[model samples]
Target: MDRWTWPAWVGVFGGLLVFAGLFLPAVVWQSRRYGRLSARRLLGTAALAVYGVALIAYTLLPLPSGDLAQWCAEHGVGGVQLHPLQFIADIRRDTAGLGLRSTLTSVAVLQVVFNVLLFLPWGIFARGFAGWGVLRSTVTAALASLLIEVTQFTGIFGLIGCSYRLGDVDDLLTNTLGGLLGALVAPLVLRWMPRPAELVQDRGRARPVTALRRWLGMLVDVVAVSVLGAGLGIGWTLVGYALGDRTASAPEVLTGLLPVALVLWLPLLIGSGASLGQRAMWLEPRWSTGEGLARGNLPRRIIRGLCGAGGWGVLTLIHGAGPALAAFVLITALAVPFTRGRRGPSCALTGAELVDARAVSPAVPRAAASTDR
Candidate 1:
């Protein structure tokens, strides 16, 4: 039980780290793939990540920490157990002369049950989340079990030098059976999860401009700037070390100017006036004239970019601008919910409108279409 508890804790902590790293990318993907976010699907995805880590922790963890040779000699088991239904005999032998209740609760019986239960989620996720058929799910589960057993048999492929845990064929059979059972009941278990086909069908539809979407777009921008800046900073530091320039460090200009220009300015000057994040979230700023139609132009796009993330980036490079930047971020964030079309400070100041990239402009009147022509 202690072994199990520690692995579960490790899985939980590792899962959180994995989710944090993947959250932005997941949001962008869900937005694009589904044309909107589904909280239920996101929760399920997170659970799957937890399960993945937990599975690895359970199968191979608590490696011989000290005196590998002594530990293996003391605790290691035979290389393999190839006999099927061996757990049945072992359970009976271990529970001999015990009452029916005691036999059912014996360690041998519980061990078999745990092995079956361990892989049950694998089948459920396969059928419910991945939408795989029973045969495919069962086969995959069996193959996965085989791989785990093989890894144990080879002592993690010779890294540990010798087998420390038994590689049991009975465990594989039980686990595959559990997976098969889960696949059979997956439809009922995951009735609320949106099917992949359903999301694909709705992919072309334009979703409303909401506050969450706006915030997500901003998050993407922040993440892009941070990643680009860090990568350049590291590269510059490495170059300095290689060239014997011990005092060389990342200049504020190189780290600050380039990422902002590439991520914000270039996009605003080009098609759609959408920053990288905005493009990822299917959002773009247009010149809103308080008329039915809104379009983008170069000058206003530049102003909008400056008033938004690009401005924030520049201020970050300037020392003693922290308070102003904080105020700008707060005001922009607050303006999203209250402003028309959910425009932030950037869009409001420049008279730019935020819209879904998929939104089609209203068809022009025949006379209007011909007049321009």
Candidate 2:
């Protein structure tokens, strides 16, 4: 056996450490929050299986034989070295070949299609963890790709004397695009093959939370709402100011508009969070109608967060006529229900309901389940 280098050891150890840290947290959080969705369990298991298969293939597959490496060396390009820029240049040059143009186009298309397919599972698993949304799911997918790339680059270089893996910037770009593509497709997949809900069930009946737990939950919700809303509001204000009035400093406008924008948009942000965040936290937010947060779903949640309060923040800072008027209308409408013991506009728009986080039983493994639903 060949001797492993320092880099190899670092790569191997580092990969393990990183994977362990990330995997453990994701599993714990998902298990606790979503409970058991048989569909999610199956999808997760399938993803792991595919990943393992890919890893095995990557290891056992023959390297571009000695001839190819020798050819590369003769051509003045160092073999088994990190040359990201050079690799991209080579790709561009090769794409211009006369006879190979058609073949290259086909290959490029196939590569993109496969890449998109590869991350579909990641998107699905991420949605189960964070709820279905393009941005959140895409972010999760990108992070996952980064971890994989770093592990591969570091581990391979350490174990072997040379960097056997070509760490291309293209991979990061492609992987993220793929992940987003997958996330975009997830909603459709979910609609057809819904996630199973038996994997994380609790054995006992739902127990009412003690005072401490209830208080803690409320605190968590409040902090999450405030931080998320404030951050989004600030971001929108900066963008609005930057695009509309280049003369005024974004900071100046943002600071001046912060309080009013926050006050007007607070209900929407809090109410949306009350619905979506509760779902992510593995609790169902039900309204007086006995319906859980009206599948206000991901799209609605994002609009409420980004457009409602966040937009109001930007408008407030800019003193924009349209947004301010819209904000006033929304605020007034929300306030109307307050007279009758109902919640604010967000609750009305999304049909906000009650929130309950009771544990059920873990789902039965997919393989063990009967075909009949």
Candidate 3:
């Protein structure tokens, strides 16, 4: 790969993610601070993203080590550079015989630059997002490098059977130095960031009813439920296999019902009247106005879930996922336009109503009020 190519790829990918962040408000109706991301959060999120990208690139790029890797494994050997300044020594040797141009073209020179530059974001992120000071940032940088080197040194913890890359002490030094430099310069580059302490907090987003918000929340729920179901089903099957039970099965209902129950129960139990989906959309199911949800309306929530995703899943399980899935999606989607306020056809099934759960002042209890006086 060209020296500049990896950074360019990171730039393009990171730019796309930033662009996607703009649409998050349309999909998610609430967050810690909803709507727009403050400058601090934006910078913090961006720094996090860039750091993650560099980490992946540095550790895992030049994939498919192929036959050479297998040969090395058979021979029981791999590359290592335990001595510090090995990079400088190699560069100096090349330049002495072949001139300075030889040093510029050398892979050793690029390795030093990329290794050092790769970790700069770690220092910036430690201070900027995590609120670590200089000393903490340096320690964090050292720890991170140690982990990376160990991973390389062990060949992805022996799964690959041999190390494909050289684990070098100089890389650690350069990476730590890069992080320290980034930490030192972070205040200047991030001067415009908003301090969360001084900034206004979100009370959540509320509107009479919004179809898009409702859809977005439901979408998040669908993904959550699917992931939950798959995890449960897969884990059960694996457990059964490990125990040597030939008849062990991973049931579809096990996947669907458990996740559905937890999603409905936990948040309501937490005194948030919202399900995971409703919370994402900043709307909650309310049996009555101004009520705390210590115990929820399980019947209503389950009814809504069935109407949204649980129903579709049951159909898929019973009818076998092809035409039934397609038909359900079409009918539900077309029904939205005819339904008043797009509140969903199922909302009427159990007399359940979706309420905007944002911005109402918390009601003080009588005992607490009296104690305050």
Taken over the whole model, the C-alpha lDDT of each candidate is 0.81, 0.45, 0.63
The clash count of every prediction, one per candidate, is: 0, 24, 0
Q: After superposition, how far is residue 233 of candidate 3 from its true place, in Å?
A: 1.1
1 versus 3: better lDDT goes to: 1
lDDT of 3: 0.63
lDDT of 1: 0.81
In the range 240-289, model 1's lDDT, one tens digit per residue, is 99999978999877788888777767777777778888888778666634
Q: Residue 353 of candidate 3: its Cα lDDT?
A: 50
Per-residue error (Å), model 1, residue 109 = 1.5
The count of residue-pair clashes in candidate 1 stands at: 0
lDDT of 2 at 362: 24
TM-score of each: 0.87, 0.35, 0.68
lDDT of 2 by residue, 1-373 (tens): 2221333343445545555444433433543544422345544544444454453333222233455445334532233334444444555655665466564565554454555565666676556433557888888778766665654555343443333455455555666777787677676655544443433345123333222222333333334445555676667767778789545433543444444344433433453343322333343333332221233455555454443334434554554477666665466344633522233344346544222334321222222211111
* Residue 149 shift from truth in candidate 1, angstroms: 2.4
